[model samples]
Target: MNENLQSSIEFSHESGFDPFMESEFHDSLKKKNPDIVINLISSGLHKSSEKYAEIFADIGSSFINATHTSIAINESFIKTFKDKKLIV
Candidate 1:
């Protein structure tokens, strides 16, 4: 995972990103917005299946700052994987 992340960071930098951001952040968003805290839900520890996880992801934090607020647009897909490594 570390190697993959490093590769990603390097790729990002090479692609013109001044500095790649960290994958994980211990941000205190809950304290900042108490309303969104109770709604905190863990995805899972580890996964062996992608069928259930391939739906949608909260990728807003990747580019937006959650300090005071956040915004994101959803790109939905209705197709399922049918090739190798494809999940039901």
Candidate 2:
């Protein structure tokens, strides 16, 4: 009984419950706490990604995006982030 199956699905920021607006969030984070640590859990997104790179770039955040549709860690990116002093 897929009553509303005909209804369309749209792509928009509001589609997901991501509360952080990226820019504003980073600005506030900087003003509110200077030494705060951000541990981003991501997948397939990087500094070159159009969808999430902007958010990651903000607040100097680092991440570990992965592949294979599993929760496995992206060791390379993680190591790089740690090496760059972005995360511990």
Candidate 3:
């Protein structure tokens, strides 16, 4: 390959693992790196998180509350539970 062509190709390949462009991860690129992500996470939860926490906390909160449910599936166990009970 010509030197210019090789250099161009290499340059195009140089931006690696940009989490902003990739939505497959649960957390942002900053969040993936604890040092940087913590800043984005905030010392206190965001308004939406706080609102939801308040709504749910009145009922209950637990890490294992929905361990068996699939968050991605439509009509998942979580959806069914939510439909069945206002608090669930």
Candidate 4:
């Protein structure tokens, strides 16, 4: 990577917050006010078939929370992208 490109990048990490908690997740988003958000949360791996409903619920809720928070912060930032593609 070019030194200039690397120097322009910024990263932040916050610990001990549960994304499933709507209020906590919204609060974190409001605090960060990030230009882009890439949510990689998943609960579908290695689970038994009996837990499919729970897994689906978890993913659904997560997606809803992320979408709501992002729209609340900046509606213009919402755009569909191909998998793993980060738009600037």
Candidate 5:
């Protein structure tokens, strides 16, 4: 997944946001000014996933999904990126 995410970031950085990208989930977010963003991160525990999460955090977006069975994004990671929002 890290490799995939690295590749994805490379592509996104090179080509701009993909209208068809899965994170388009943020579309609704842009509408309501969501304060929390729940997403599946357990499946993304790999190095690249962590890297991608860091990038997302830099942009003020936290990812939480069904995979986040604990109902919380990692506090340590969250603290590093203050603006990013999280949801359960």
Candidate 6:
């Protein structure tokens, strides 16, 4: 299964960067120009509401920022690939 999946798809790995930094994030996005982006970061997953609030004053905002940035960065590319979906 892993071999089949690998043969059918191309995957790239990047790490050691903070998504909150718009410039760095955007630069990576522009470089990759991926057709799909799956955001697996769950902010405040097991924490209480108060704790979550205290921990992240603006939780989930980064996802939104990433999504918008992806759209903006891939505007022209998306126009070409009309069926492509941006799942950030």
Index of the highest-TM-score prediction: 5
N/CA/C clash count, model 5:
8
Weakest 10 consecutive residues, lDDT, candidate 4?
A: 60-69
Candidate 2, position 33, lDDT: 35
The TM-score that candidate 1 achieves is 0.19
Predicted candidate 5 versus true structure: per-residue lDDT over 1-88, tens digit per residue: 3684443333344657664464552443343443444444666455545554554554566555445233236676767665444432
Query: How far out, in Å, is residue 62 in model 6?
Result: 16
Q: TM-score for each prediction?
A: 0.19, 0.31, 0.20, 0.26, 0.35, 0.28
RMSD of each: 15.3, 10.8, 15.9, 13.6, 8.4, 13.3
Q: Each model's C-alpha lDDT? A: 0.25, 0.40, 0.31, 0.33, 0.48, 0.34
lDDT of 5 at 76: 62
Model 4, 10-83: lDDT tens per residue? 32337565435555444444454444433323434323321322222323321222221232233332232212
Best by lDDT: 5
- C-alpha lDDT of candidate 4 relative to the true structure: 0.33
Clashes of 1: 0
What lDDT tens digits, residue by residue, belong to model 6 across residues 1-88?
2584334433333755553454553444445444443332344342332222222222221122222224334454334333333221
For model 5, the stretches where C-alpha displacement exceeds 4 angstroms are 1-45, 65-73, 81-88
lDDT of 3 by residue, 21-54 (tens): 3232222322323211101223344453333333
Candidate number with the higher TM-score (1 or 4) = 4
Clashing pairs in 5: 37-86, 37-87, 38-64, 39-63, 39-64, 39-65, 40-64, 40-65
Provide the clashing-pair count of each candidate structure: 0, 0, 1, 0, 8, 0
State residue 45's C-alpha deviation in candidate 4, in Å. 8.9
Total clashes for model 4: 0
TM-score of 6: 0.28
lDDT of 2 by residue, 5-78 (tens): 21221124465634345554454444543333333434454442423323443445543333333212446545
For candidate 3, the TM-score is 0.20
